[model samples]
Target: MRENEGGQERPGGEVEEPFGFWRGGGAHERVATGFEETPFGEVWERFLESVDTTNVGALTIGYWGADYDTHFVYPVPLLVEAAASFPNLRSIFLGDIEAGQSEISWINHGDITPLLEAFPALERLKVRGADGLVLEPVKHESLRVLRFESGGLPAGVVRAVAGSDLPKLADLGLWLGDEAYGGDSAVDDLAPILSGERLPSLRHLALDDSQFQDEIAEAVASAPVVARLATLSLAMGTLTDRGAEALLSGQPLTHLRKLDLSYHYLSEPMMARVCAALPGVEVDLDDQQEPDEGEFYVEVAE
Candidate 1:
């Protein structure tokens, strides 16, 4: 719907009222209900209303691939306003941003600070490819699930998550991409996550693309409160069979039922060896991949 306000086109085109809906009010009021030259703020308010209806207990929104431009054309402030209004919102998933521009050029921006502060009941947050996903002061206690992908959990992010008073959190996912880049030390950087008695209620840990070098194995192996963890994912990393073996060796992850090691280089025998070490645990080694011998200086098992 194209709106011509004094012969000027609106940013989101024009608004057309749904003709089929019955309106009890006068024509002007009825038309105003649906037809308005919506500014970015109005668009965000409408978005909040659409998602907040029915008082739904949980709402999950995902933005992936090149589609980010479509959902993020609005200014950051408006988006923050929209996010804060969703009282019942639980999970937020984000992935692959082709055009990374909004409130901040990076994925970890300070704009999301207000939303985290306002939503006290927020539960799950999964962010991937959001370059500007900076740390925000968290006030939500009902939060349970947290996941990150394609980016390292920076110091600010780890500090924020660790400092949160989320007593109900269970699932924690962190994927810090390949280790060759500055990500090799990511595991060590997340020391606060495993330090002391933090994340007491955390039960499941999913780590994909993040290399947990041997340096932090002790921290991961000795995580005091993650004993109840039932599932673990260690996909796409420099994690050797040794690291996997080390991570599960004499660890509190005795409750692990599912383990995914896809895209990592591991032979059937090494995989079998790891599985034998953790009897009863199902290990997924179906998609094991290794760099070509010419490209890789290290010996790779088939």
Candidate 2:
């Protein structure tokens, strides 16, 4: 369930994952264009020919080819070259490949700064996978939602995002997965984000799918950023009663509109306590998990 197969929801609407380019007149508002055996360059050329890319609001790049490790590097430049064609491009989802095409951890990625540099008006960006991923902190004014979906997100990427100057960023989601798969970021790397110094407009925050969910929860309990967030998500990790207790004992969360703690390892009593503590808040306690012996596992770690 953690491995994403369908397209994600954007500010405009749900992303449309059409198998191929539209033949004549189909809604190209929020669409995903992809190919399997054919070269991506050819697909790109055909896509430009088929659809009026200028009117497309949101785009998702799904399953480029068989050899994604090398093929993954091609999308950025192609998109950059075709930047003029997508004048209305506001949101983009890179590496939207399903589990059947490639595992989340195995989807090799490259530097995506060019895409941001090209589309200055882009408001949202969501990327999947972290292997070979590179991002240097750059100031972006229009970006409101930035999410990185990974079974193992790199510390460098986390640092880069924290260091970036995003004045209008409202939603930030980072899936800090198991360290075994290259998720090397510690809580210290998240100090800038937790301090709420760089992200002035951040309202919805998700620091999910980590091996050290408890430690992250402990930090988030007292984080200055928590005070500003309307919705806080610490889901898809191995959160036990220990982490839940920290949240309960931390600053009052009655101000928040929603608290997402799905896919957790909390005891029944702790779950009840969380629900009772925030009667006004919409708390999501779905996908309860039990620890195996004394060890715990994250939802997605390849």
TM-score of each: 0.66, 0.87
lDDT of each: 0.49, 0.82
For residues 250-291, write the lDDT of model 1, one tens digit per residue. 465546776766666666678777777667776766666575
Off by over 4 Å in 2: 1-36, 66-73
Model 2 collision count:
0
| lDDT (10s digit) by residue, model 2, range 1-302 | 35422333444784523222222232334323344466666677778888878678778787665443344335788899989988888778788777876788887678888889999998878888887788889899999889898988999999999999999998899999989998999988898999999999998889999988998899988999999887899999989999999999998899987798999999899999999999999899999997788889988888
Model 1, residue 272: distance off in Å is 1.4
Q: Model 1: C-alpha RMSD to truth?
A: 13.5
